[model samples]
Target: MEAHHSEIRILKEIAELLNEGTEINGLLSEVLAKLLHVTGLSSGWIFLVEPDGKHMLAAKENLPHALAYNDCEPMCTGDCWCLDRYNNGRLQKATNIIECKRIESALAMKREDTNGLTHHATIPLRAGNEKFGILNVGAPNKTHFEPEELALLESIAFQIGTALKRIKLIEVEQETALTAERNRLARDLHDSVSQLLFSLRLTARGGAEMTADKETKETFTYIQDLAQEALSEMRALIWQLRPRGLENGITSALLDYGQMLGLKVEPEVSGVISLPGKVEEALWRIGQEALANCKKHSGQEKVLLRLSMEAHQVEMLISDCGNGFYYDDKQGEIPTLGLQSMKKRAEHLKGQFKLKSSPDKGTTIQIIIPV
Candidate 1:
């Protein structure tokens, strides 16, 4: 009876944590810590698997030195029994994996401390037919888990899985709403501000052509030029919101945008154009920014854009042979807001950004993103 009550208390605390509605990462970390405290487990971690079968270490608590080495590099990558079983649809419940492959490898290498941990209980987190990922909990010298322990873990895993599904649905709905708003704004800009700018430019041109006085004609010409510049800027903004040509592919869309900016875009693409939606969107935005920068800053009218696709990653390079300013690479600082924005877009997708520039040698921007 006492053990059953303890289990109930654990469930109650965990249920409360799940109900707190915190961010997923923070909620998972807090729940893992709470579980460890109540169950006396030495360490625990959670993996959130994407629909494409890629798994990420969502949360961890009290990792042993062996697995925590190199910034937990071991845990972040590589395949093990639990993951293999999970991927194969065999890990349906809480059970003890034969042994922790990561720990075994760490021990064999003798590079970092394992703190005597050799085994763990792996629980598949699922809600109905949907499988989110796995929850792993273990302790020093605890090679196997009892039935009661596994049952408790299974119950908690169910709650976590349901919460994950709810959160993901919410995210999808929010994204859909945001996309709708962007389209609406783009339409409004095209119909209102864009048309007004075009009309203003036409009126200024007519005034310049009709005026008799030289000074009045010059003033009208200046107005016409300013209106034309504003119209170009407005068109760029509208394109960013809608990205009308993106349906075909990122490369094609980028080529069209570069042409719109009056730059000679020399594009070289390798491998298939298929990419994840988020990655494709990010790359498209980054490419647009790079091309816009080339048109505005680079003295040359031509730019080279290269896209390479590999099994695990994609690379994009944009370069121009123009009068370039000296860039101080030693400090690793981005000199312009445009570059900073591009860097942030790449990093937000867990990718890399590199920039190189020198006087008379021109500038090169490279971005690599894992898909």
Candidate 2:
């Protein structure tokens, strides 16, 4: 009766380990140790079946196989006895398996060394529709495994197989969620900012052409200047809208990027500007974007930018001599996301912005950010 109760307790413990919420490695190790204790065996191993149904030794104790680990027990099928027994749907023992026909004729041990192991029992590990692997215990004693002991080991192998399946499902779910987030970011960038930049560029090109007209050349020049000024502002807006969190304060950052793009920026600050931190950040980003546009599209050699503070607000002014673009009130003209972002940022802080430019003349952007 005492022996019966002990087996029952060990079986329950194995079941709990298989179903536990802990990590997979921890649970498997506990299962292996408990199985050895329950069977009163000193040597054993767990085998994993590869996709091809070949048996690979995964875990072992008190003896060494090529693949044995406390943390990992990867196994391949077709070569090991444990895998063969799992495919045949039986928990089998081979105390002196060299005498069995299946072990002698079916296994390739006829050419391999036999002293590595003389006695071992193999139990099939099954979960759902598939046989995952095998559990094996061995000893020098030929009669070490009894009929009742083999039955108990099979039950433990079945439970472990189910745990592996659940782990794979969890990994798939996490991968799906990561893919979804990347897709959403791609869509947002294309729809909002990309379309606006394309339309704004067309509008600028039209203005540049009109400045070459004979009758209204001067008027077209003015329009061209305003268009370019607006272009720079729009570019500033897009940088702020960027999700990657580009960092720069309006004055110094503007100078840095301008230098990179083959332009000189002589920036000056005065009157101790004391705007809110985010407002300063937005203005700096706007200035940097404006400088970037000038290098890329303005056709200018040098720009002068100045920042100063008033009683209640801080102001920024950027001036550049560059080919100008005409301003049109066309209804279908697209807005650049960068400029929209700048406008939104300015409006958010209840600040004011002013832009000035022309074809032969220069361009200037003035922003007043409140404290």
Top-scoring candidate (TM-score): 1
lDDT of 1 by residue, 1-371 (tens): 99999999999999898888647899899999998998999999999886557899999999998898789899999998998899988888998655889999998897558887899999999999999999999998998898888999999999999988888788778877887899999999999999999999999999999999999999999999999999999999988998988999999899999999999999999988788877888899999999998888888999999999997789999999997879987888999998999999999888999999998999999999988
- Candidate 1 residue pairs in backbone clash: none
Q: Per-residue lDDT tens digits of candidate 2, residues 156-198?
A: 6667777778765675677557545655655665576555655
Runs of candidate 1 exceeding 4 Å displacement: 1-9, 49-56, 65-81, 84-90, 101-116, 127-132, 327-331
Q: What TM-score does prediction 2 earn?
A: 0.44
- The true-versus-predicted C-alpha distance at residue 356 of model 1, in Å, is 3.1
